[model samples]
Target chain A: MIQAEHLTKRYGFTTAIQDVSFEVRKGEILGFLGPNGAGKTTTMRILAGFFPATEGRAIVAGFDVFEKPLEVKKRVGYMPEHPPLYEEMSVDAYLRFVATIKGVDRDKIDSRLGDVKARCGLAEEGSRLIKHLSKGYKQRVGLAQALIHEPEVLILDEPTIGLDPKQIIEVRELIRGLAGDHTVILSTHILPEVSMTCERVIIINNGKIVVMDTPENLTSQLSGGERIELDIVGPVENLPALLREIPQVKNVSLGEPQNARQPVLVETEGSADVRHLIARKVIESGLDLYRLSTQTMTLEEIFVKLTTEEETQEEETE
Target chain B: MRNYLAIVTKELRTLFVSPIAYVVLAVFFAITGYFFYIILGNVIEFVMQRAFQSQQFGAAPPPFDAPAAVIRGFFGILSTILLFLIPMITMGIFAEEKKRGTIELLFTSPLTHLQLILGKFTALILFLLVMLVPTIVNSILLYLLSEPAPRLVTMLVGYLGAFLLGGALLAVGVFISSLTENQIVAAVLTFGTFLILWVIDATAGTGSTITNETIRYLSILNHYEDFTKGVLDSQHVIFYLSFIFLGLFLTSVSLDSGKWRG
Candidate 1:
């Protein structure tokens, strides 16, 4: 539903986004993961037709964002970083105004207003002025405005930034329910949000996209092999040699001692089930197993790895 | 067209919702009312003096037209008061939106820049019309109280001139609002620009004849004089229309530049 080709934006001599390109498929919830100043908002604004890209083009819902911005704007609902709202207006009045300007049919405005207010949990606050609402409620009103027209694509920038944990979960549920009917592209620095809500993830750093894949793939691809962590109480010098004898075991390394027990990492081949064999071997070796846990790299670790890897690469080239 | 009307309504609601609009209205009417009282007082005093001289020395006094003397003079000062008050009405039209980050909503909607500008301009124009309601009431009372009825055509033409002049000034204010995010800055800059236009005629005699003529033509008060005289010349109409167009065109250009820079 959305395509961006070599999209670059420059503010005078400074480039906000350089050669940024990504595609979002229909009915897919794509999480845009990036650190601060990573050009995520800039990219979203360009795609939403808020402004023209300096050096490239973006197409949303089969219309050019630069040439046919009105068409693109009609199909996309964009909630900027700060929910663009008129504070003096009541919630009902504000949503009605947004629906009208968004080109919702005159006959459908009342129904659309009802649907969005109920969906965003704002039905009760309809008569209250927006400035009187709390931050979380104001944010919901922002979401309500974005969802009023039921656009095909939703470009939300940090939709759950300042909410409480319960509100966050509620918003996540709401976003999750939007899949299969709406193409959502949400950008945030929160890693677990991507892992929990998105089908695909794009990691960007310093105005460049560093990695793009599913969360699981990103974890495994960065780890290079499946890893199992082991904590045992025994002489660790011969553990590597003993664990290497197993057919499925590839490599074993012992970590530093803590509380009279040493941690060991066991690397296994692809999709191998060797935990049973390793537990049995620990019994035969006359060693006390304090803890044995199988693990893989997490999305946070992958994010740190990819972004730091880019920095080191630049340092090396320089 | 529906989008334009939607924006216009939305803006008008915003204007009425804020207390600043009430404060501006109060200040506007207070000034115009005080000026009306003083001018009418002076006219009545001048008439008494003329009547006394005619009775004592057997000299005839000049003819007095209450509607022309009071109404035209009232509107004349109304323009000067409008010069100060119109900026307050327009300073927040675009500047407040930019400061609050609501301009994003307008820009991302399926509305064109021209539509946005016209919608906002129309809302301010409507507010100006609403503000003139009290003066209209006062004019009606004067018409009812007159022994010899006032000339309706001259009064209508005079009010038309006031409306067009206020429209031109409002367009200028909108353009100034688009250039800044601070309302105070917008208001001050608008007032400053109008002040310069107001004083341009003062320098007419200091320069060469051709330069003096050009300066006199550029002065806002110079073109507005014919309207107060009940003269509906097309040249004056065209001048005010062109002034309004120039201001709106600059505002639209500023919006385009903002989009490109953003």
Candidate 2:
């Protein structure tokens, strides 16, 4: 439902976003992953039509954001980095104001308010002044305002920045439940949030799109080392020699000694798990394998490598 | 029109929800009450002196030199008060929004810049009306107490003129508010600007004695004079309308510029 082409934002001598392009299909939860000053917020702002892009254009729900901003604005709900709330007003009052300004139907406002409050777990606190609420509640109120209009697309920036772990899970569950109904593009630096909440991940660094794919795909693509650790009851010294014969095992290192047991980290070049073969080989070699543990590269490692501040190393290697 | 109503509601709700509106109203009434006290005291003195002169000099000139002098006096007094009052009410209209980051919500909404400006300007007018209530009470009491009786129509016209003048100044205030996110800067600059306009009006008179008028016409007080004399000149009407329009236009332009840089 959203398409950005060669989007760029420049301020004087610095470029906030540069030649970034991507597409989010309908009903897909696209997690925008990046660090601070990584053009994530800038890109979201352009998509929401709050600012015109310095170059190219963005189309949301079939309307060009720059050429027809009002139409785009009417169809997209955006929660900025801050909640964009008036501290003096109650949560209900603030949501009502947003609904009015967003051109939601007069008759549907009450129903929409109820729906949004329930969805964001804010049904009981609508009458309280926003300034008086805790930070987590404040962030939820911001989300509720964005959802009150019932727009087709939701653009949330760092939606869970200041919440406790339980609150974070609740908000994540709320976000996860939003999929299949509306197109969502949430930008956050938190890694597991994307892995848990998104169907697709777009990694951005230095104002450029590094890669776009499913989280599983990106992890595997960058998971260059998946090791299997074995615990045996036999000798530890002869363990490395027998495992070297396996074709899939590229290199192995005896893990630094730890409490009660010795560990090993393995790097593999093949797609198959070598744990079973290594285990059998150890039994045949008469070595005790006390522990067999596998470590696979998660989406976090992939994201860090993709969006790391060390841009040149990854760019040249990729 | 729906956009306008929505923004108006938003502005009114914001204006009433905070203590600042009440504080501003109270401050305005207090200052205006004090100014009224001094002016009433002086009016008593002027009338007494006129009475004494009549007894001594036989029908000495009536106190009013020309209606225009009173017009100038009323405008001068109101303009000075507005110079202080406009910024307090207006500095937060756009500046506070920018500072608190609520302007993002506003800009991203379906409402346009014109709607936002008009809504804020209307809210300011409502606050000004609230300030006018006590002034009306004062007018009624003064009418009952004065012997020769103040000119009811003249006073009514002068008050209406003051209202319009405040509207124009608040529009200017709104424009100034849009230029910065610092309320203090907005208020200070707004005061400085209106003070300069008042000084210009006092110094720059209708040009040559013959077929007069130069840059004195640019003064806000110059344009506001017709209303104080109970004269609703079409030219003055046009002038205030243009001034209001210019302020609003610039306010809209500033908001639009902010969108680009966001």
Candidate 3:
């Protein structure tokens, strides 16, 4: 439902996002993963029509964000990093106001208000003053406002940033529930949120999309191949050659020796199963093998590696 | 149209529910009420002294014309009071939204920039009218107690002048508020700009003939005085209308520039 092409945004001499392109299909939740100052918010803001892109084009729900912003805005609901709340207003009042401005029809407003309030777990707190509520409740109100109009596309920036763990889970569940009906583009630095809640992930770093794929694919595909961690009680000086002698074992490196147990990290080619061979090799060599386990790359590891590597590459280029 | 009304309704709701707005309104009423009582009392004392002197000389007293002397004078003071009070009412209209990041909500909505600006401007005007309730009540009291009541047409015209002048200043305040996220900065800038407008006539009086004429023409006070005199000249109406349009236009341009910048 959303397509951004060569989306570049610059603030005077500083480029916030440059040539960042991505797409979100209908009824899909796309997670934008990046560290702080990674131009995630800038990209979302451009799509929301809060500001125009310095260059490039964005189309949302078949409307050009720049040329037909009002049409695009009608179809998209955006919640910024900070909940745009009027603290003095009651929850019901704030939602009602948002519903009205979002063009919720006069007759449908009541039902929509009830629906969003219920969906966001805000039914009981409808009459409470927003300033009196905790931060989690305030976030629910923000989500409620975004959903009040039953928008076709929702762009939420760090929807769970300040919430407690329970509230975060609740918000994630709420977002996951919205997948089949709404096209969602959620941005955050949090990794598990992407894995748990999003179907597709777009990892943006330094104003560019460094990687885009399913969370599982991002981890497996980006990290090269299989890895195995071996903790052995033996003299580790000649272990690299012995481990490399196995056919599929691509490389081997020893970690620190502590209390006579040495840690060995073994790399293998794509999806290879070399555990049995390594076990037999340790036995034949008379080395005591204390611990050996296949280690798959986590999303966090891939994320840190990709983002940090991107920074290093940029530094080298500079 | 519905979007505009929605925005206006929301703005009014925010303004009325805030304790600070009421505090400012109460303080305004107290100050204006005191001035009203003092002005009425002085006009009454002057009328009585004239009656006494004329009776001793076996002649009629000069026509008091309370509408001209008192009601018009009251409106004149009302305009000046609104000079300070309008900024208080408008300082937070855009600045607060900017500070709280609610401008994102408005900008991303389906509403047009013109609709948003007009919606907010209309809300502030309505709030200014609400603020004038006590003054209206004071006028009603003068209407009831005076022997020869204030002229209905004069009272209406003078109140119109006050409203138009207040509307123009509020528009200027809205534009100033849009310039910054700091309400205090917005208020101070609005006040400074208004002070210059108020004193422009004084500056005009000392300048050369052509300069004086041009400055007086540009001065808001010059156009407003005619309305206070019960003269319904279309020129003053046009001036206030154009001033309001200019302010709103500038505000819209300022807002639309957000798309061009960050």
Candidate 4:
């Protein structure tokens, strides 16, 4: 439903986003993951028709964003980073106004209002003033405002930034539930949000797209090899050599000794299950195994590595 | 058109719900009411003196149009008061939206820039009309009680001038409001601009040179004077309309430029 081709935006000397290209299929939940100032918001703004890209083009809901902005705007609902709201107006009045501008049918406005309010968990808070609501409720009202028109595409920039743990879960669930009928492109610096909610993740950094793939693939591809962390309590001077003897064991390194227990990190090639062989080899030796667990690189480590690695490469080139 | 009405309704709701609207309305009514009372008192006293003088000398009192004099004085003061009050009404029209980040919602919506500008302009005009209600009623009451009523056409024309002048100033206020995210700054800038326009003719020397004539013609008050004198000069009407269009056109250009800068 959305296609951005080499879209770049520059504010005088600084480029907010440069040569960014991505496509989001109909009814797909695409997550844009980046640290702050990483052009996630800039890319989303371009797709939503908030501003024309300084170079290139965006096609949203089958309408060119620059040439047919109004038509694209009619089909795309945008929730900005701050949840653009009028604090003085009640929630219902605000949503109705948005619905009207989004070209929602006049006859169906009341029903659409009811539907969006319920969907965003804002049914009871509809009568309350927006400023009077809690932060979580205000966020929900923002979501409700975006959903009121039932647009084909939803562009949300940091949809769950300032919510409690439970509110965050509820919002993630709400976004996840929108996958089949609504194409969503939500940006966030939160790692788990992208893994939990998006079907495809786009990691952007410093005005460039580093990678775009499924969450599971991103972890596995960046990690290079499977890792097993072991805690052994016996004499561990020979543990590295002993673990390396197992077939397909690529390398073994010992961690610092703490309270007479030694932590060992084992690297194995490919996706093979070598834990049982390593356990048998440890038992044959005199070492007593206190803990044996395989660890995949978490999304947090992958994000840091991906974003930081690019900076070092740029520094080296400079 | 639907989008325009939607924006108009939304803006009106925003205006009415905030304390600023009520404060402006109350303050405007109080100040204008006080002036009306004072002007009426002066007019009544002057007419009574004329009557008494005629009775003493047995000569017809100098033709004193009490209602006309009252309207002239009331409208003159009303326009000046509007010069200060209009900035308050329009200062937040776009500034608050930019400050609160709602301008993103507006710019991204399906509505055109002109629709948004016109909607806001219409809302302020409607509120200005509401603000003029008591003044209109006051004049009608004066007409009923006075021995010689004010000329109805002239009175209507003066009110039109007030409306047009308010609208022209409001258009300017809207343009200034769009240039900044600070409401106070917008108000100050709008007031300063209107103040210059109000007294621009004062800069003209006592000469019929083309430069002097242009300066005198540029003063907003110079054109408004014709309406108060019961003359609906098309030139004045065209000038106000063109001024209003220029302000709105500049506002449109400003909005478009923002998109480019962003």
Candidate 5:
């Protein structure tokens, strides 16, 4: 378990992260979603005891990161954004070195080595020098090093970055499989990685936590006032008039579709979906309804809306 | 303790697998071989009465040839050269990790700063011993062909002296390596620092006798000279211990401070 209270990390005059607080429970997978330069990595570093919080405190696995770092370090396994790896070492040697440094039992090193190497997909390349391994393999080796001691808390920053789609999926699956035993906190800019691999998300922007909730709740929060898009093969000018007559419709807008196949861009008001109304109208008018898709406000839309509003507030203050 | 050994093993593994060991050994052997050949050839000719021109020899017709003294002389000078070479060896200690960003992995581990520092120093000392082996072999070769074998204790003292001096320099080098991520800068600063320590004695050479002696004692070279002569003064032991302690202390502080500065 990890809990932080008003964690602030300032670099001279600039505050990289300020007043950030969050808690991750046992066996919970939390995603730190932030844009670049949003202090995501800085917060992770503090949690991992790699950097001291400037004004606040973090307790990781029941040990204060600043005051009792050795115990916290013992309980946590951190894979930094860059995946700290030594190029000259082989995969096996590096993992073994990490295992020993983490104080893994001497007798269990062999079994730990076997278990970790297999789990991290590094078994086949145990003998390969790290420098010679591809980026994906190097990442796997990094994950192996983190898991070598069977640590209870795993903090991985952007674990799936810079990997091919297949490699990304593989890493994601690996991270997903780690949720039951290890309290995992992973940071990334990719939204769906959180949706797919994490149960809860702490969306951080401008060094502050904007929202923290389950994936379902976050999506559902933005679910009201649903938007719909339609492609009707009829008089473009008549589409807006017909849509306005619907009882649930409050407003409609017709514009050039981004794609030639889309034909018409439709904006609807109110939470009620009018896809059925437009469908009936289209057939009655003897016009072809080529495509109809219902759109809900997605996580991407919510993210943009909240973060842009934050920027606008800042601009107004300035 | 296990963590310390783990780090040491890791260092040894790197020393074996990387090109640094080969390159360092090649350059070390090449330089030491040249000096050895000159030292031996001069001694051989001097013994044969072809060229007995050096002032280091005494006029007594002593029973034992001064083979041991000659070996000591060689190691004393070799250690002086090591003041330069060991810095190069330690340049990669912390600097390379900082550069490659692998230091995060080590720093975030459960090990204490003391374990990390001691582990690194142990590896460097072991490597220094490995460097000494070939030179020791060079001495053995000299003994087989020479008329009077070297006084074993005297040669042993010189090698031990060299080891102590090497340890001190290595400590300084590790600290310097931690101050920066650039290896070249670390190597240069490390060498420059020892160079200053190497000459600290001579600055008081013209002053009062007591001042001169104290400064000489302050110089690492002077403390090493006592050991080179085969006397393990408690003073010299303290001096080397202080060197190890100071170096490790400063490195630990430097690393600890990084946690504070954003």
Candidate 6:
């Protein structure tokens, strides 16, 4: 539903996004994950036809964004980061106005309005002025405005930035539900949002795409090996040697010992289940095992590593 | 066309919803009403003076077209009043949208720049017509009171001048509004531009040189005089129409440049 090819956008000498490219299939939920100033919003804006890319092309809903922007805009619904809204207008009036400008059929406008209001959980708040609503409700109204036209593609920049925990969950669920009916591309600095809602994640940093993969794969691929953290309460001087005896164990390191309790970290190669072996080895060694748990690198760690890795690489080259 | 109407409707709704519209209407009506009364009193006073002089000299009173004089004076003051009030009407047209970040919604929508410009221009024109309603009623009242009613064609032509002049200024205001995101800045700049255009003929330096003639012709007020006289000169009509087109064209260009700057 969306194809961006080598999309580069520059404001004078500073490149906001450089040589970035990605594709989103029909009905797929694609998440753009990056730190601040990572070109996430810039890339989305290009795809939404908000502005032409400085040196690239985007085709949205099968229309070239630069050549036929109106057509692409007709089929792509964009919700900006700030949730562009008129505070003076009532929620219902605002949505209806958006529907009209989006070229919604006149007779079907009321029905479409109702549909989006219900979908965004804004049905009862229609008559209330938008400025009177809370931040979460304002965000929902923004979502409703984007959905009013039933466009084939939805581009949302930071769709869940300022919401309570429950509102965040509801918004994530709403976005998840939008998949298979509307192709969605949402950008956010929130890591778990991508994992929870997107089928595919694109991690961008410093005007470049660092990595792209499924959430599970991203965690596993960057972790190199699974780790098991063990808390043992016994003489632990020989624990690392004993745990290393296991065939699948790649490395073992011990934490500071205090009150006769020692923590051990065991790194194992491949995806093999080596926890039972480690526990058995600890028992045979006469070390009383108090806790044993497997720990995989989280998306947060992966994000920090990938983003910082690029920074260090640039420093090294410099 | 549908998109155009949609934008027009939206603009009208936004205008009426804001307090500025009512404030502008109240100010316009109050000032114009006072001026109307003063001008009527002056015209009546002049006629009574003439009757007294003619009775004293024992000669029939010379014909005095009271309604014509009143309409002429009314239109002259009306234009000056509009000179100040138009910026108030158009200052927020584009500036507020830019400030609130709704310009993104508009630029990304399926609507063309021309459609957006025309829709806003049309909405302001409609509101201008509404503002002129009481003045029209006042003219009708003046017509009814006179023994020989005012010429309907002349009254209508003068109104046409008022509408065109308002539109031309509004078009200029729209262009100025697009140049900034500050409403006050837009209004002040628009007022400044209108003032310059209003008095540009003074700079012609009393010379018959081509440059001087061109400068005199460029003054918007100079062309408006013909319409108030009920001449309906195609030259003045073309000038106002072209002036409107030029303002709108520059607005479209400004919008495009903004996209590039982004």
For each candidate in the order shown, give its overall lDDT on alpha carbons. 0.87, 0.81, 0.87, 0.89, 0.82, 0.89
Candidate 2 segments whose C-alpha is farther than 4 A from its true place = A225-318, B57-75, B202-214
The DockQ figures for the candidates are 0.60, 0.51, 0.57, 0.62, 0.53, 0.53
TM-score of 4: 0.83
Instruction: For residues B1-262, write the lDDT of model 5, one tens digit per residue.
Output: 8888998998887777778778888888888888888877776666656224333464543443557556766876798679868877899899988888888998899888888889888999999988987788887887676666666677777787888788889999999999999999999999999988989977886766887878877799878877777777888878988998899899999988876663
**Segments in model 6 whose C-alpha atoms lie over 4 Å from true places:** A221-302, A305-318, B55-64
lDDT of 6 by residue, B136-189 (tens): 878888878886888988889999999999999999999999999999999999
Fnat values, candidates in order:
0.84, 0.76, 0.87, 0.94, 0.92, 0.77
Write candidate 3's Cα lDDT for B1-262 as tens digits. Answer: 9988888998898898887689879988988898888888888888889989999999998766865788767877888888988889889999999999999998998888888999999999898888876578887888888878877787789889988998999999999999889999999999999999887878767657998988888888888887877889998999999999999999998887756675
Residue pairs whose backbone atoms clash in candidate 1: none
**Candidate 2 chain B — worst ten consecutive residues by lDDT sum?**
B65-74
- Which one wins by TM-score: 3 or 4? 4
lDDT of 1 by residue, A1-318 (tens): 999999999989888889988899999999998877888999999999988899888989999999999998898899988999999899999999999999999899999999998999998999999999999999999999888889999999999877877888999999999989999999987777888999999987678777789988766655544578999998878778888888878779888899998999897775668888888788789898888887644434546764675466446645
For model 5 chain A, give the 10-residue run with minimal summed lDDT: A258-267
lDDT of 6 by residue, A1-318 (tens): 888899999998999999998899999999998888889988988888888889989889999999999889889899999889999889999998899889899999999999999999998999999999999999999999899999999999999877767898999999999999999999978777788999999988789887789988876655655668889987888777777778878788898876777988887777678788888999999989988997653444647765674466446645
Docking class of 3: medium
After best superposition, candidate 5 residue B17: deviation in angstroms? 1.4
Q: Which residue pairs collide, candidate 5?
A: none
lDDT of 3 at A135: 93
Classified by CAPRI criteria, candidate 2 counts as medium
- Could you tell me the TM-score of chain B in model 2? 0.87
What is the DockQ (computed on Cα atoms) for candidate 4? 0.62
Question: Per-residue CA lDDT of candidate 1, range B1-262, in tens?
Answer: 9999998999899999988889988988888888888887887788888899999989788788766787778889988988989889999999999999899999989999999999999999999898887787767866788667677777787788888889999999999999989999999999999998988999789757898988888888888877777777888888889999999999999988888777
Task: Please tell me what DockQ candidate 6 reaches.
Answer: 0.53
Compared with the true structure, what per-residue lDDT tens digits does model 3 show for residues A46-100? 9999999999999999999999998888899999999999999999889888888
Candidate 6 chain B, which ten residues in sequence have the lowest lDDT sum?
B224-233
